[model samples]
Target: MKHYTSLLFISSLLFCWMFISCKSTQRLTDWSLVWEENFNQKKGFNEQVWSKIPRGGADWDNYMTDFDSCYAMRKGKLVLRGIVNHTQLNDTAPYLTGGVYSKGKKVFSDGRIEIRVKLDPAKGAWPAIWMLAENADWPVGGEIDIMERLNHDSIVYQTVHSYYTYTLGLREYPKSGSKGMIDPDCYNVFAVEMYPDSLSFYINNIHTFTYPRIQTIEKGQYPFNQPFYLLIDMQLGGSWVGTVDPKELPVEMKVDWVRFYQQKSIK
Candidate 1:
């Protein structure tokens, strides 16, 4: 009888220790919210944090515009629209899109960035949430594409670009990125957790893939450890996404919120 009682007490103690260990592990991995934008203001996007992405010669932003009709704030959401250019007869582009960047206003590093958004499908709609280095130029600096949806795709692309991947064409060597399934009709959460050694991508809280820094003589194998600014845009008629159908013009992408988080255990 004494032997039986001793065994029960030992088992109970072991169970308690295991429970505490599990909780501690979870706590260490948990995140503490650092900054967030809910777009709850009655006016447009907070100018203190965002600015209209300038029109560039690239196919992606050639039609980028500062038109009032392409941007709106409704019911705590930032709405970016891509519309046919009937009203803007003076503007040569056939379409105008709305986009904003935190280039000079806000920047972050070594943390997780998440965006909750819903996209409306158009024949040539391309909406993206991405990050770019604050000071460095293209390919060499690095590009982190948290989420990019082309047309009516049910899956979004999460990718990273660097000199190694683009210039040297070493895309598959270190696994540059991945694509994850998403719901076309409803809002989905897309996130990228940036660490000094790796960038982890997730969709709807499901782990999609991780791109790690490996030992290499390549000059720009991992340039993502530096500060980066965020960009969210509603783009249309890109060569990769094909031609726009005027019948489906005026499509929009609704952004519910954006958040940045750091590990709770970190300072």
Candidate 2:
């Protein structure tokens, strides 16, 4: 009887230890909220966190930049309106759309980024919340797309494009793309938790995908260690989105909030 009781006590102690161990691991990541934006301002978009300029680097897009009426803040929500206008951007695009990037304003190396948003349910309304390297050039600098829904897609794509993944095609084995089902009319939390070696994507707090570091691959393939800035936009009539419906003009991409957190355990 004593042997049996000792065994039971030992087992109970072991189980308790394991439980505490798991909880400690979760507690290790003491995340500190670094920056956040709720878009609750009554008048205009915050210029300190975002820039109104539409970068000319998207050579594949067939649209121009417009700052006058393309974006607005209504009822504490930031709206990125995509419209068909006669606005000419170097005679290349006649449609006026809105995009905001945090190039020189704010950037982070390793942290957690979350954006709560809802896309307008209109065809050719391509909305995305993503990040790109601030220092390096296109593809080579690394692009981490937390959520990109195009052409009224019911699914959101989470992808990473880097020189190692795209230019050299080193990411051919594990397949560096993932998607999650989402509703266009409702607000969903799209997030990316960037670690030292990997990027984990989440939608509405559910884990959707993970882009792990290729330790065996070349170092050039991993460009996520550097500081990356955020970009939120509603791109209209791009090559990927096809033609727009004039009747669906003035599609609004509403953003409720955005947050950034830097982990203290990442030393």
Candidate 3:
């Protein structure tokens, strides 16, 4: 009788645990799909939603170009490439990379966004899918790096940077971000759920980490509650990722699709 009672108690506890686990994951399913992209057209991305990222002096965008060789739509995917300057005889930059941003056309707050991509690893390749505040300057407003894969890393980094983290350097307490292992050769889903109080990151639907808003008087500690725009780029030879290996030129990042969802209660 004692053994039977013990078994019954254990069964009851297991059932409760499974129920709670399902409820927790059901919170994410409660979101309603608001926007999505499949990249079905061949004339590059929808201009109404995305604009070619302009060249900048910064390493990330220094090689950004709208050259034909840098962008393509193949097999229903958006392909952004980083290639050695073999064409554009007039251009002087040794490398040219493809990038796009949705600043004015699409901006959202307090929502979940997911991107499915396949990263091609190369010695100097640095591909990223990230977001920045639409109306505020960088580091001041905040930067949310959903995914950043450097070189041939088997894991992708998901990070958040703000004045607190970058200027004041207060990242140790809250731990701004984390890394997740990924299959370098296959498509992986990188996502983030941005709320007014915290940001939850996930890789392939598995929760990785969460950066929560902490009680502090510091500026930019949690500036992610505002609307932000997206930036997807195929970068090469950045200071963080080191110098480019010419032999590894023509690397690419294939984006299968992107989707944005908001809490069902939002509207």
Candidate 4:
């Protein structure tokens, strides 16, 4: 009987050790820093780390523009500003400036992504910090929006798009009253925690939404497991942002930083 009791005790101790170790390993908050860009001193986008969206109207979804350098650095911040100019395509009015991107450079997968950004409060500014799969297709591999703003309100959106479906999750804080605004500059830290089984969105340190992994990714399609490049742009007057107010021209989206973290491996 003593021999059996000793064996049981040893088994229980082993199980307890394993449980504690797993609990520690599963803690997402204890992530290790894998990559980050503070954007503190650089005057322009790093060519080695980022590629510019070439000057052209074909790349833009539907917005019209006569591309002339739309991005600049001012007072230690990366600023995307819109410019309006006349174009031969439309003689009735002047062409408005816009931006769209992600061609080459840094890309990755299966990690936490964060961006610190302040957006323009103008009526037609649509600014976004997002990611697209390395695969040469649209929504086939996947798309993850770390932060997106529509000038209609102070609210911001974080979303994930797959070939199967698109999900837009929202979190808003008013500038005053019971729902006080999270920040004064209309800016906040936005982050997305991407895991094998789920995705979580965080705004200004507050957890807002969690999406469970979809099983059977449909037609054997699971593209999110691959690396994706980041895209940051300030589009003017799109379906989401609507028509621009001429008085609101030359609006800017300020980016403080972009960071990435990865959970440590259990093994």
Please, what's the RMSD in Å of model 3?
7.0
Each prediction's Cα RMSD? Answer: 9.2, 9.7, 7.0, 13.9
Per-residue lDDT over 1-267 for candidate 2, one digit per residue giving the tens place of the 0 to 100 score: 999999999999899868855764464358778889999999887888888755464622345465578888988888887787765555455567787888899897788898989887677777888899999997888999998887768898999998778888876644577989886678888989898888888877667878887656465667788899998888776667677787878888889999888887555
Q: Which lDDT value does model 4 have at 65?
A: 38
Q: How does candidate 3 score on lDDT?
A: 0.92
Model 4 segments more than 4 A misplaced: 1-29, 55-69, 86-102, 166-184, 220-222
Q: Where is model 1 more than 4 Å wrong at Cα?
A: 1-29
Q: Name the runs in model 2 displaced over 4 angstroms.
A: 1-30, 55-62, 86-92, 217-219, 264-267
Worst 10 residues of 4 by lDDT: 171-180
Question: Per-residue lDDT tens digits of candidate 3, residues 1-267?
Answer: 999999999999899868856864786678889999999997778999999999999989999998988999999999999999987888899999999999999997899999999999999999999999999998999999999999999999999999999999999769998999998889998999999999999987778999999998877799999999999999998779998998977899999999999988754
Q: Tell me the tens digit of each residue's lDDT in model 4 across 1-267.
A: 999999999999899868755763565457887887765554666667766554444323344333444676666667776655544454333434444354566786788887877877777767777778777576667677777777656677776666555322111211000111335276677777777666677776566676555455353134467778887777666666677786767777787778888877777
Per-residue lDDT of 119 in model 3 = 98
Residue 69 lDDT, candidate 2, scale 0-100 = 82
Clashing pairs in 2: none
Residue 238 in candidate 2, Cα distance off native in Å: 2.6
Rank order (by lDDT, best first):
3, 1, 2, 4
User: For model 3, what is the error of residue 61's alpha carbon versus the real structure, in angstroms, after optimal superposition?
Assistant: 0.7
